[model samples]
Target: MANTPQSKKRARQNERRYAVNKARRSRIRTYLRKVEEAIAAGDKDAAAVALRAAQPELMRGVTKGVMHKNTVSRKLSRLSARVKALG
Candidate 1:
């Protein structure tokens, strides 16, 4: 579909970026799932630890433009609150 050389280059770049972003998003989801499982199991200590571990990965997603800042903020806020309530 990209007729011009520049457009073709951009298309290739987009594909690469898409793959990278997909992997990043999947990684972030794994971290979130860890926190969720800990919380669901009602282990406050484990939940806290998982939350702490997920924080950086979530922030990295935001910084890398894979996710929006406000979205990450909301996710962290809700997760932290749930973890806090697990006591």
Candidate 2:
């Protein structure tokens, strides 16, 4: 119940931000899924490439406040390790 004008504006802003963040999150997941699929298919080169592409997107999400820095770091670390282990 945002009765105040300021509160109503804030609610609208929140909705817009939520939609944008949701899209960003979905985009990130799509990138991650590409890497995962590559890994699952045993394509080390493709997985490595996908991981490389995904790194910046994930970091950007962190910078945009859509994701936590450590969360992205841990994900990148784990994914990198797994990619490295792929032979």
Candidate 3:
């Protein structure tokens, strides 16, 4: 569909970026899931440790443009609250 060379290049770049972003998103989700599972298990110490591990990954997602800052902020806040409540 891209007739122009520039458009073709742009399409290729988009594909590459898409793959990278997808991987980043998946990685972030994995980190978040770990925290969720810890929380669900009601292991306060484990949940706290998981949250700490996830914090940097979530922030990395925001920095990489894979996720919005406020979204990450809200997630962190809620997860921290739940972890706190678990104890």
lDDT of 3 by residue, 1-87 (tens): 998999999999999999999999999999899999999998999999999999999999989999999999999999999999996
Candidate 2 per-residue C-alpha lDDT over 1-87 given as tens digits, one digit per residue, 9 for 90 to 100? 999999999999999999999999999999999999999999999999999999999999999999999999999999999999998
Off by over 4 Å in 3: none
Report the C-alpha lDDT of model 1 over 53-79, residue by residue, as the tens digit.
999999999999999999999999999
Tell me the lDDT of model 1 at 8.
100
Tell me the alpha-carbon RMSD of every candidate: 0.5, 0.5, 0.5
- For model 2, the stretches where C-alpha displacement exceeds 4 angstroms are none
Q: After superposition, how far is residue 37 of candidate 3 from its true place, in Å?
A: 0.5
Models sorted by TM-score, best on top: 1, 2, 3
Q: Candidate 3: global Cα-lDDT?
A: 0.95
What TM-score, computed on C-alpha atoms, does each candidate reach?
0.98, 0.98, 0.98
lDDT order of candidates, top first: 1, 2, 3
